[model samples]
Target: MSDALSEAIPVLLVAAPILAATLPLVFGLRFDRAGWLFTTLTTSSLFVATVVLATVVYSEGTVIHQLGGYPRAYGIELVADRLSTTIALLVTGTSAGVLAYTRLGGPRGNTFYSGYLLLVGGLLGLTFTGDVFNMFVFLEITGLATYALIASGDGPESAVAGLKYLIVGTVGASLYLLGVGLLFMATGTLNMIELAEAIPQAQGGYENTLVRAAFAFVFVGFAIKVAQWPVHAWQPDAYQHAPDGVTPLVAALVSTVSAYALARVMYTVFTVDFLTQTPYAREIVITVGAVSVVAGSTLAVIQRDVKRMLAYSSVSQFGLVVAAYGLVTETALVGAVIHLVGHGIMKAGLFIAAGVIALGYGARTVDEYAGLAARRPVVAGGMAVLLIALIGIPPSVGFVGKWYIALGAVQAEVWSVAAVIFLSTMLTLAYSARLLEKMYFTPANWLEDPHAPDADVVATDGGSGPGLTRQSDRARPDAVSIGMLSIVVVAAVLAVALGFSGDLFYDWLEPFVSEVFN
Candidate 1:
C-alpha cells in the first residue's frame, strides 16, 4: 500500500462504523427489518477495512493519520500500528461474528442494532485514536452503548445490571479524564506521542508529582474498566443479565478493548523508560495483576451461574495480560497482545455456547449442564473444546499466549510471577473441570426429585417440564438457529488453528515490539 492509502485506512476504520451507526435508526423509519441488514453490512465492511489496515501495518509500518491534515504536535491523530490494528481486527471480526447469533437469536430491533453499531464505532475509535483526550471521548461512547445494550434484555434484572455498569464505568472514565488533565497540566499536550516526548523533559521529569499522580489515577481507572478483582463487581451481574445475543459481543470485546487501551496508555503514553526509571511502578503493576489472577479464578470456581463464571474467567485471563506488561520485555508484550486477542475469541465462544445452551436446553449452571452433550452434541463439543483451551491446553490459542508470557517472565527472572503464571492453569481448571464433568459424566435425571412436593416442581415453557426453575427458561429454544451454532464452532476451530500461528504473530509484531522496547 502507498503512504496515502495507509493514512486513509485508519480513518475509514474509525469513521465508517460511526457513519453506519446512524443508518439503522434512520432506516427504521421505513422498514422493520432494516437493522439486521444494516448491521451485517456495516460490520462486514468494518472487518474488511480492518484487514486492509492490518495488511498495510504488517507489510509497510505503523500508519499514522493526522486528522484534517494537521501536524502530529497539535492535531488529533489515528494510529494503526501492529498492536492497534491487531485489536481493530479482533473488534471488527468479533462484532461481525456476533451478528450471526443475533440475526436469528433475537433482541432483534432497529434500536438494538443501532446501539450495536455505536459500540463497534466506539471500540474502533478507541483502538485507533492516538490522543489521550480523544481516547477518553471514545471510552465514554463505548460505555454508553454498552450500558444500553446490557439493559435490552427481557427481565428487570437487566436494567439493574446496566445501571450498575454505567455508574462504575462512568467513574472509570472520569478518573482517566482526571489523569489526562494532570498529564496535560504537566506536559501541556494531549497527543500521545507528544506527551511521551514531553514527559521526560517536563519540569521535574520522571520523579515529578504530577506525572506520578497521573499514572496512578490512569492505571486505577483502567483497572476498574478492565474489571480486575475487587473492582470487578459489575461484570458478573452485567454478563448474567444481558440479552443472549448481546452477551457474546459485550463479553468478547468490551473489557478486552479496555485492557488494550490500558496497555496503549502505559506503553505509548508513559513509555517503558518511565516504568524502568520510576519508583514502584513495575512492582505495583505486577502485584495488581498477580492478585487479580488468583482472586478471579477462585471466585470463578465458586460461581453457580455459567455466565457469571465466564465473566469472572475474563478477570483472570486479562490478569495474565496485565502481568505480562509488567515484565517489560518484547516477548512479554507480544504475549500480552496475543492473550488479549486469544481471550477475546475464547470468551466470546464460551459465552455464545452458554447462550445456545440456555436457549436449547434451558441450562444455565454447572448442575443444569448435566448430560448436555447428549442433548446438543455440537454445541457441547464446541463448549468443551473452548473450556479446555481456556485451561491452557496444548495447541490452542490460550496455551500459545500463556506460554509466551511465562517464558518472558522466566527470561526476566521473575521467579514468583512465573510461578503464578504456571499455577494459573490449575486454578482455571478447578472450575472448568466442574462444568466438564457435569456436561459429560453426570446423568440429567439427577436434576429431578421423585420425592419432592408438587409445588416445588412447576411448569416451565408450556408444560414441557415440572422441574427446577432456571434463569434461562426465559428464552425459547425454537428461536435458536443454525447460524448461532456455526459461530460457536467457527470460534472453536479458530482457537485451535491460531495456536500454531504464534510465529506469524511474532513476526508481524517484531517491528512494533522493537520500536517500543529497544
Candidate 2:
C-alpha cells in the first residue's frame, strides 16, 4: 500500500465510528432497530481496516499521519506502530463481537447503540492519537459514553453506578489533564514524540520537580482509571450494575486501553532513561502493582456476586501489567502487553457467559450457579474454560502471560513482585474453584420443574392440596440465542489457542520494544 493510503486508514478508523454514531439515532424515527445493524457494519469495516493497517505497519514500519500535513512540532499526529495497531484490533474486533449478544439480549435502543459507537470511537482515538492533551480528550469521551451506557440499564441501580463512575472518572481525567499541563510547562509541547525529545533537555532533566510531579499526577490518574486498589471502589459497582450488554465492552477494552495509555506515556513520552535516573519512580510503580495484586485478589475471594468478583479480578490482573511496566526489561514489557490482551479476552468471555446464563437460567450469584453445568451445559462449559484460563492454568493464554511476567520479574531480580505473582495465582484459584465446584459438583436443589405453575413454590407433601410455598424475587428464565452461545465458545477457543502464540507475540513486539529500550 502507498504511504498515503496507509496514513488515511487511521483517519478513517477513528472518524468512521464517531460519524456513524449518528446514523442510528437519525434513522431511529423510521426504523427502530437500526442501531445494531449500523454498529455491526461500522465495526466490521473498522476491523478490516485495522488488519490492512497492521500489514502496512509490519511491512513498512510505524505509520505516522500528521493531521492536515502539519509538522510534528505543532500538528497532531496519529501513529500506527506495532503496539497501537494490536490494541486497535482488540477494540474493533471486540466491539463487533459483542453486538451479537446485544441484538437479542437487550439494553436495546438507538440511544444505547449510539453510546456504544461513541465509546468505540473514543477508544480508537485513544489508541491512535499521538498527543498528550488529545489523550485526555479521548479519555473523557470514553468516560462519558461509558457512563451513559451504564445508565441505560433497567434499574435505578444502574443510574447510581453511572453517577459514581462519572464522578470518579472525571477526577481521573482531571488529574491526567493537570499532568499534561505540567508537561507543557516543562517542555513547551503536547505531542508525545516531541515531549520525549524535550523532557531530557529541560531545566533539571529527569529530576525537574515539574517533570516528577507530572509523572506523579499521571500515574495516580491511571491508577484510578485502571481500578488499582484503594481507588477501585467505583469499578465493582459500575461493572455489577452496568447493563449486561455493556459490561463486556467496558470490562474488556476500557481499562485495557487506559493501561496501554499509561505505558505509552511512560515509555514514549518519558522514555526509559528518565525512569532509570529518576529516584523511586520505578519502585513506586512496582509497589502499587504488587499491593493491588494482593488486595484485589483478597477482595475478590469474598464476593458472592459473580460480576463483582470478575471486576475485582481485573484489578489483580491489571496489577501484574503495571508491575511489568516498572520492571523495564524487554521481556516484562512483552509480558505486560500479552497479559493486557489476554485478560481482556478472558474477561469479555466470562462476562458474556454470565449474561448468557442469566438469560437462559436466571442465575446471577455464585450460589445460583449450582448445577449450571446441567442446566446450560454449553455456557457453563465455556465459563468453566474461561475461569480455568484466568487461574493461569498451563497451555492457556492466562498462563502464557503470567509465565512471561514471572520470568521477567526473576530476570530483573524483583523478588517481591515475583512472589506476589505466585500469590495472585493461588488466590485466583480460590475463587475460580468455588465457582467450579458450584457448577459441576453441587446439586441444584433450588431449581424447580420448568412446568411448575409457581417456580418458587415447594409442595411439602409431594402433591398435597395445600403445601408450603417459598417466595423468591429472581426473574424468570428468558430464551437464550445461539449467537450468544457462539460468542462465548469462540472466546474460550481463542483464549486457549492464543496461549501457543507467545513466541509469535514476542517477535511481533520486538521491533517496538527494542526502539523504546534502546
TM-scores of all models?
A: 0.96, 0.96
Error of 2 at 448 (Å): 9.6
Local distance difference test, each candidate: 0.89, 0.91
Please provide, for model 1 over 165-277, each residue's C-alpha lDDT reduced to its tens digit, 9 standing for 90 to 100: 99999999999999999999999999999998999999989889999999999999999999987788999999999998999899889999999999999999999999989
Model 2 segments more than 4 A misplaced: 447-454, 457-478
Q: Among all windows of ten consecutive residues in candidate 2, which has the lowest summed lDDT?
A: 465-474
lDDT of 2 at 72: 87
Q: Evaluated with lDDT, which candidate comes out highest?
A: 2
**Where's the lowest-lDDT run of ten residues in candidate 1?**
449-458
